[model samples]
Target: MTQPEVEPVSPRPSNLNLPNVLTTLRIVLVPFFGAALLVDGGDSGTWRTVAWVIFFVAMATDKIDGDIARARNLVTDFGKIADPIADKAITGMAFIGLSIVGEVWWWVTILVLLREWSVTLLRLSVLKRVVIAAADLGKLKTTVQGLALGLLVLPLLDPDLPSWLETPGEVLFYVAQVLLAVAVALTLWSGAEFYRGVWRQRHELRGSGKS
Candidate 1:
């Protein structure tokens, strides 16, 4: 893997590349996901299933692109920026959409959203000076969220999920909640660690001062 000299992942894949395109497609689907939930006029209701499936597929792309990029060594500068944006758009909309529909409390939605947006901005700030990619915790959080969101949307797809598994909605919701909580903790921890790394390296940079 050829690393960027100054910035490890600098000049990452461009927005027009395959992975980034997938990310943009996912972001574009957020509104449709919300609309499929909020507004229903028979046919609109049918679209809910499609929306849910699409949501999961979109989320799947997130997982796929990263793996492909890393395994195939196709990671791009644009992927770095676009991937997280896709994540926030999808998650923020779902959380807020559920709140708007009175499914989950707005407070919960806000909490999740605040963590997501804050961490995103934090990454932007930290990445400007340092080169920290997504960490284990962040990945864990995304897994939980994607599963939770998929399950939550599943109900919309099929209100009666396999007669045996009762209370699937609540089950998935709580599971996702737990995962998100863990994710939040990790996000905060990673953010702190990133800053600490930056702080420690500040003097080292001054000593070298190679541009």
Candidate 2:
């Protein structure tokens, strides 16, 4: 018997919805990635390398999924919401795991995670009334985060990696650290703009008796 065909998540219809599948894959991989981090604890080279490879692939998926979704017109509310949540989970868990192993600066992880959570809350509070899509700065922030996380993850499991141009981990660490700081700034700025938009939307709607 032919099975029932399920509808895709996006309101826009397209068979080339690669982004949705990639986002789904990222969600599925988060737990395994966490487990790998635990197993690679205490700076074990082999396990760290394995963890990094998996993380790299997962991070790559983050970019690919979004691009595919946009290109294929499969941008759904589900993808809009869940994709960022999945990113934070994977990145946040690794940040915490890396700190636990004393590989990353604990304060750095705390600061970054705080920014992530704050911006997430701000977006959630306003997503319903406004389209809180990624601004250019936010997209740049994600790129910065992907690079920084890669550097951070590598050192946690394998310290031999030279992050930027031709520098060692120590040098690359600070560079990625700076980029993370910048990303946080961008996140906050963009978030505030989004909040203002939502506030305006709500006020206007209420004035029109639409709310």
lDDT of 1 by residue, 1-211 (tens): 9976774554544446667677778888888877876665313445656767778878888888878778856676577777888888987877776666555567767766776787687777666566665667667667766766665555532445556555665576567666656655665666566567666666676678931
Top-lDDT candidate index: 2
List candidate 1 segments past 4 Å from native. Answer: 1-15, 41-45, 156-211
Against the correct fold, how does model 1 do in TM-score?
0.72
- Supply candidate 2's per-residue lDDT for 204: 89
Q: lDDT tens digits, residues 1-211, model 2?
A: 9999999775555433667678778878877766776773545655665667878888888888877777867777777777888788878877888778775678878887887887787777667765656678777777777777677666432544444533565676677767767766766776667567678878888999978
Local error of candidate 1 at residue 110 (angstroms): 1.3
> How much lDDT does each candidate structure score?
0.68, 0.72
Candidate 1 deviation (Cα RMSD): 6.2
In angstroms, how far off is 57's CA in candidate 1?
1.0
Runs of candidate 2 exceeding 4 Å displacement: 1-17, 121-126, 156-167
